[model samples]
Target chain A: MPVRLYLSHVGKSFTMHLQGGTTIPVVSGVDFSVGEGECVVLGGPSGAGKSSILKMIYGNYRCDQGQILVTVGDEIVNVADSEPRKILQLRKDVIGYVSQFLRVIPRVPAVEVVAEPLILQGADEGKALARARDLLTRLNVPERLWGLPPATFSGGEQQRVNIARGFIAHYPLLLLDEPTASLDAANRAVVVELVAEKKQDGVAMVGILHDQDVRDRISDRIVDVTAFRAEAA
Target chain B: MTDFFSDDPLLQVNGVTRYYGDRIGCRNVSFQLWPGEVLAIVGESGSGKTTLLNCLSTRLAPTAGAIEYRMRDGAMRNLYQLGEAERRLLMRTDWGFVHQNAADGLRMTVSAGANVGERLMAVGDRHYGHIRETATDWLGRVEIEADRIDDDPRSFSGGMRQRLQIARNLVTHPRLVFMDEPTGGLDVSVQARLLDLLRRLVADLGLSVVIVTHDLAVARLLSHRIMVMRHGEVIETGLTDQVLDDPREPYTQLLVSSILQV
Candidate 1:
């Protein structure tokens, strides 16, 4: 399998003005990558710019310098250098992201949440709904909860729903930040096994987690951001 | 263990049940926190671990139970029976809250110093200099660098923010503390460091704590007594070392087995 997500000399930073016009850089130079069917875990202390890497991979933030190359199926594209139109298409068709905070649209049913990615990618309503139901069942979300809104569910259930949304369409690359943080040992094992199952289906993943158990369960490669920073220093 | 509980428990909860409309939060949940002891509540999400903490800390009203607090005035008062003003007074003087997300428990807009000092200010410590000194002192105790006292919490990393939140809660010198997964968002190394800090703080302050977490290792590291909850009921409860080493419950055994330590 080839590399699905690649970053070479990736550096992301934001400038902040201080009391007397002094500026501070938030995220310094950082580099990492992931391949098809591979799971990478990024670990670091808080404020070490871990979340920034995910955002950059998902096209939410543009890097100050360096490039991010994402290859899926027959296409290879530079995420950082891509035009806005191409970036939108790339995110819509190939890249999927589950944020640290499970941001479900309030009052929207879980079925709708899962199916929205397909709907956004221009799939027919019936086909998308069927796909969403299948994904939810595979992810172990109860059938009765399908039409119910995410807010009615507990933290762990909501996280499962979030994962379902990102995986329902079988997008080539998946980015998850603390996806299993709310789950207990039993449920976390199920989710980790599910991620492995998805990887066997050729879905690539990069997850950020503080839980070493979750990290050990899902990761093929571990990237220590704090250690990387220290070596760079 | 008897010598540990020689003095009366600082906080006693009995037959507690909390509900939201038709939904049950917890039922017949009972526990006691003696001074200088750590009691960990381990449960999956929706197991009512957090609700139990809320009821004990008087943050949530229990529909069917009583939380008796041995007050400084040498009188025992049921927390649920207290009036709003009385609850407010109790909150200011006796208890502290550390939420799962440090950002939720902290005022992110404020500097770290002000965040810690807010507790002192709440309890009527009006002297700015005194508040600053106390805040700096507690921050250092929690292993947060003192030079970052004036930095906004937004600038701190996840681990540092959690430490700052713990410092904020501990600064008030509350006899009883409640923490909901204080290390949930931190990396493993940071979690170990924070656990070490908490162990030291619990020993030094002699503060009784009810910490809610889903991680068994966290329970092993910080707790003396462990309660395993499932579906809003206590499935098992025992000494941390004993229960974790030899879990009797099938669910607990399953939970223990799923952990693949490297």
Candidate 2:
């Protein structure tokens, strides 16, 4: 299978500019290649920088060294050091991210939050809203909460909204951070089924999931992140 | 025919033809729909799929031909041959038709709950509380907010309205359903998700569906069997997988391979 994401000798460090430019290193010499239709999970305890690895791939955090190449259509992009505009473009076109938190403008409804990705990509507003409603419903988020923003929603409800927003786009490389964390068992099963469907559609996924059952069921392989803990400078 | 019943086919459509003045809408179509089977009738615009669907579902009278429906009593009754009241009863209880536009199928001014419960009320379910409860349950089943059951369907968006229409039709547990481009106007993602929901409902309810759509993808996703129609005539008929994977007819192959520009 053709490789969709290739991370070679990746290294990241946080430099405190005020503290004599000292560097706190995380994720040094990390190498992995995720093929199309494969899901490589980041597995480790807290503070192991799994989220940072995702951020690096998403171009939210800069890598100090090595290549974070991603293929979109026929183009291979080095996401680690891509231009800011190109990174933004990639976020819109090639990469989809679902974090553990729900972040939306205050007073914006859940439907719009989930629909924004498609709307931003020049899809019709009515069509986008319809698709968003379907995703939110499938995630088991009550219909009453759809018109309400996540600010007033419960933790599980917000998480489901977050999840619905994430899977609304068709991205080749999807980065999921604890997708089913706050969901109930039934809703979690819904997400599991959705992930299985996406896998069958051949989307390359990288996820950080604490739930062992979902993690084992979805991942093609586990990338241990215990060695990537950001140490004190 | 006795052959259809012995094999348990739910509906037999034979030699169905329709004419709109000098223009022929459709001509000489025949097929059998079995229980739990989804049969998609695919054709280009004005290719007579809608006309055929209308004829089979009793929305329009065919100029010449007969549609035989297997009644709940396990008897073969010609749909067009039935009395007005009997046809209406069959439409209400035995079959469902999902329109492309939800507005045509729904009561615009009434609450979504009322729209869903209207069928139950028509079928002589008198208890107000049971009807309301059932409406709420159906709304939940279609992923509508139970709280919004009191709100009118006009207040909802297109996808929500389409889903509500589906709930209203399916809540009565109709043995057969006729869908006219159920996901036509929706976005790609919306279409995908709605297809998933429809697949789930069909499986759960053991529904027999005769859906008319120009979209080959829709046919591929839902239909057990597919009958390709063109120029108001049946061109090819086979299992959906076989027909889609290896189409024998040139017209069908072109239709299948034609890129969906939508």
In DockQ terms, which candidate is top?
A: 2
The 0-to-1 C-alpha lDDT of every candidate, in the order given, reads 0.78, 0.84
**DockQ numbers for every candidate?**
0.01, 0.01
lDDT per residue as tens, model 1, B20-67: 888889889987767667889997889998888887887788889888
Per-residue accuracy of model 1 over A1-233 as CA lDDT, tens digit each: 67888887777544322233233344555677788899988877887777777877776666656788888567779887764335556777788887535554445689988898888677898999998898788778899999997866887778888877876676788888887776777667767877887799788888887888878888999887764342221
Q: How much is the lDDT of residue A29 in candidate 2?
A: 78
Per-residue CA lDDT of model 2 for A3-27, tens digit only, reads 9999988888765434555566777
Per-candidate total of colliding backbone pairs: 3, 0
What is the Cα-based lDDT of residue B244 in candidate 1?
66
Clashing residue pairs, candidate 1?
A: A46-B157, A46-B158, A47-B157
Q: Which residue runs does candidate 2 get wrong by more than 4 Å?
A: A1-233, B1-6, B260-262
Candidate 2: CAPRI quality band? incorrect
Evaluated on chain B only, what are the TM-scores of all the candidate structures, in order?
0.94, 0.96
- TM-score (second chain) of model 1: 0.94
